[model samples]
Target: MASTLTDSLVGRLVDGRYKVDSRIARGGMATVYLATDRRLDRQVALKVMHAHLADGASGADFVSRFRREARAAARLTHPGLVAVFDQGVDGETSYLTMEYVDGTNLRRRLHEDGPFAVGEALQVVGEVLDALAAAHRQNLVHRDIKPENVLLSTDGRVKVADFGLARAVTEVTSTTTGTILGTVAYLGPELISTGACDTRTDVYAVGIMLFEMLTGRQPFVGETPIQVAFQHVNDDVPVPSTVVPWLPAEIDELVCALAARAPEDRPHDAPAALVHLRRVMALLPPDVLGRRADAPPPVVSFAQGTPDDTDAPSSVGEIDKIDEIRVGGDTDEADGPVRGAGATDHLTQALDTRASGSTIAFTLPDRDRLAPATGTAPAVSTSPTAPVDADRPGRDRRRPRRRTLVSVVSILLILGALGGGAFWWFGYGPGSFTSVPTGLAGSTLEDAEARLDAAALLHESVEAFHDTVPAGEVISTDPGDGERIPKDGTVELTVSSGIEHFVVPGGLVGASVGDARASLSSVGFTAVTESGEWNLDHPEGTVLGLSVVEGESLPHNTPVVLAVSKGPEPVVVPQVQSLTLDEATEQLEPWTLAPVVVEEYSETVPEGKVISQAPEQGSAALRGDEVTLKVSLGMPFVEVPDVLFTPVAEARTILEDAGFKVEVNYFMGFLGNEVRSQSEAPGTEVRKGSTITLDL
Candidate 1:
């Protein structure tokens, strides 16, 4: 597995979140890749199922099951467990995401350095049990437990990996089918005999792992995995002290107690076993806890690195196929394990299938061939060596490649079609967008809507006034006409309700001229002309009316003329000359004129008549002006004094000067100017023209 351009999925984005960077390891079921989580911006271990499993007839069911299992693993949150973050299927690629531990796993540590001292082994086992305890509390079982699954982080934390992935493969592995699922080395007896699983099954695997840690070797061994699996059912894991003579008896008892053949014989679960192991740790002497029980194994390094770093199988022949022993196969290692199965490698393994009183083997990629110590060791790691292409676990090197001319041509054609469809669907099809219809600014609403509908665009109509556009015609579009819009997106259509017009309100007559003008202006009549007109009916300063008729609808700013009242017309003097006082008073009533009478004498006119008026006839006068009239009185009387003895001419002169004519009368019809005797008594009051007679 070299880093190259042809390394499938090495540069691919899985489910749009994880970007596969490099191949880490591969197993019977899937391949583990070191990838970056594009969304979270962190490194992760991406385990993608092999193409065979994902593209098989039961691929859908397998992926569905895998998603469910991954979800279950993701729910378990503990510091000691490698956190499962997400799981999804992108096309045929079904994958799971887990936290990347920088340091190697326990198997690598044991390979680099031999068996751990009592304290170190207890520490590793303690962390494993802690993680298992949490899972078991939630009724979850780790079907595969081995050094490969126990990861040691560079920051000094021990974590258990692969929580609920095994169960997902129980019925999907092509080789194993419905049989066993985990490695053979750590399969519980119950898993081999009867497919019944519980927390106790994991406890059994942990015990076996404990035994291997103390003695630097597994409790059982054989030429084939069948022999090793049968040993767990028929034989008891010997006390670790048998191999490591200096190992404590309590540690031996801890191993034997957890690895019991019967489910009930083992501590009920990882919790009980954890409690028991802790008790043993408390009882063990400090000196014993600090020193290794066995000599260190020679350090071995390879250019291809350990099974954890490469696609190679474990050097100790840790790969185990459960269905081979169950279904009776000569070759082909099954990736699934019996419910509680631990094999040589880690990271990738079979699903857990429960069998009773029987141990099943599942091979996993062992990523933990790290350097271990009892009390203290370097808790850091250098970069892994590059992988080599070779006969590796879980992969069939004999699988033929299909690259015929016809197949290549067919694939090219299919890709071309797919590309074209994608382009149209996201570019010009319903998935993309379109422009609003052009020339819709003044188009009818019905026409604009029809065009929008043809363009596959929705529309909304709004009414507004337009100066140029006609009524019911489109004024403008929200994105403007011809602007881009989504194919199914709504366009705001502004329809013209016609030019804005207002009506001058009625009832403005008799109102204040200013108020009337304001009322007219309120309805858009800004231009106004005002004038004062005398109105008898309306009061002064009130509106006589307007030049423009009220209640007439006109365009905005139409001019209006307001008629303001100055009052009634000025009164004219009446011609009451020679009229009586009553007649004059009656004739002046219309003018509201007051008649002021002054008695005046008229020589030839009768008395008590209006001789003349002060404001003469037909003259303009105030409404309350008075007209002075003079009434006629009788003429003055003259007295005749010794006119008979005076000269005749002198008598005539005297009479004429008195405003009277003197008539002379003889004894018989004499005509003389002299007055001998007056016609009437001279002492009487007579008119000035009284006749006077004189004797000659």
Candidate 2:
């Protein structure tokens, strides 16, 4: 399990786009956070490398390598592969935004549910191998292929993630830093011994993972990582059936062949491994396929014996001594023998000394000891002076010779029996079986029956509804296509009853409401119109969204709620004429209407008063509508002008020219030729266009 540093990055936004919501998980290299991609309005997983690893002198190199790996992973576009959206560096925080997976990884599943059934294990590994096949085809090798990297989504979708250790297949070494990469338990022999890696290395890791998934524990375990890694280089992976005796023999063979000590012994690539696995799966019976019980309890190696005399090596002291041979950078070399004469001599001496005591150790110096740890021939030295007393009597010497011969003959006989049993089980049993008919899916029932008859296999039809297959055509087979079945065995055929269910198509998010509804109806669904809300961003009649996401499968005639856009909501304009500017602005605030005040001189309205408004009042408008208000600034000031001695008509002309209304005050027909007095004093500042009375 990985631990997260208590860094306060939780509410911090990375690169100004990914707003970190909370921490998802922390691994040895990076910490993942659930974040929102503000630009795209979608959730993404933000993987931020530790600051210490991203900001030191060697940080640039690590960050650059991280970026390259991220780019490489982003190029792979398969449903089984987790999608990488974006990558960048923010200050000292180097991060990658990826598609957030909504399920636990295989490690969690294994811990909670124990080992998986043969069929389920094969399915999970098959999906992982399929994903690896895609990567291998692109010349990419996922260096780390462990259970922690395999995700089991909630919808029963298996996806492979964490391509952080992935590199191009052409790369000779795991890293330029000269440090061995990958978990020790899953590291391949070639990678551990020579520092050389390729597609087969990944295959070897998958094999180890398969073994663990089947046995509920890793194949190799030690007190230290170096001890486990040495096991990978020096020891062959044990057959799974040794631990889980109920497992099929074919499965054991497949796992052993995959986890072989030599690279040449494993599959060429993921595709080749997948082929072998599928064949193994096809040969399994229902007892093995459907066995859903927990794995048998782990066998303890050290109960009441010395460490070296146990069924398996129980002490790290002996294994750690093996690492001494490759110390001082010798492990980095790709050529020459890694084990020196001193190491072998030391191991031989230890075994001889231990055998001299009351305890009986199982250590052997022969290279044949590298055989699998299962029921293979046990290690027995043929040397005459191995652990015998030559000073005894001549009869004693003869008796020792006779005992050694009996032991050797007995071991040979056991080996022969084990070999013959394996041959019979695979050669004459399930391994020689015929595969079920191919192209049976979507084939007419009559055609499928003919094919099955030609193959000498029995058939039973099981009717089911298939969305894509036509009526009376075979949708699937019980044993599945390409599955191996014994001669004349029964294969269940499921024929389609036409498209009785509807599957929604993708890319319906931005489509128009009418087109989306019509598309749903065309696919045998009832498009129910749901009440729509006003969306300012989306255009009218455009689909705001749907009740369910696209690509969902539903029963026939199921009602799909369609949410259309009604555009922006309409607002009612409030009456604000003849009111003060402040009052008018207050009145329009509730309607979200903006008030624009334009000041002008007016004789009928007072200052700061709204004389009239655009679009009048009580008019319908959209929210955020702008309403222009014509406000009054009172009458303009003007001089009365010197017209005391002028005639009334002359004065009137002068007053009118100065933008003022003039009125004559004639008492009893007295026609005054000159204006004696004016209502407003001369040189006085009065309102422009104001009425002025003149005395005659």
Query: Model 1, stretches more than 4 Å misplaced?
Result: 1-5, 164-178, 295-309, 312-696
Runs with alpha carbons beyond 4 Å of true place in candidate 2: 1-6, 39-41, 173-179, 298-696
lDDT of each: 0.67, 0.71
Pick by lDDT: which candidate is best? 2
What digit string (tens of lDDT, one per residue) describes model 2 on residues 288-364?
A: 88886465565332111122321121110111011111212223145433335533443444434432222222222
Estimate, for each residue in 1-696, the C-alpha lDDT of model 1 and write its tens digit. Answer: 244346779888888889898876665556778889986578888877777865768877656756776777765656677667677778877888877777767777777787888899998898889777667655677777877777777788888876543443223223333244566677777665545567778899899888878777777865444456557777888998888778777887788888887775676656557767887898999999998866534332110124343453222111211232232222336754422233322212232332321233333222111111134566997898666457567665444334466688899999999999999997988888677778987789999999888887878876654445789998667566666677779876767777657787999887986567556644544356778886666777798778777777876445567888877668888789988888989999887778888886677767677777898998997666678888766565666555656667787787678766666656566554445565555556676666665554
For residue 157, what is the lDDT in candidate 1?
82
- Candidate 2 least-lDDT 10 residues: 315-324
Model 1 error, position 679 (Å)? 94
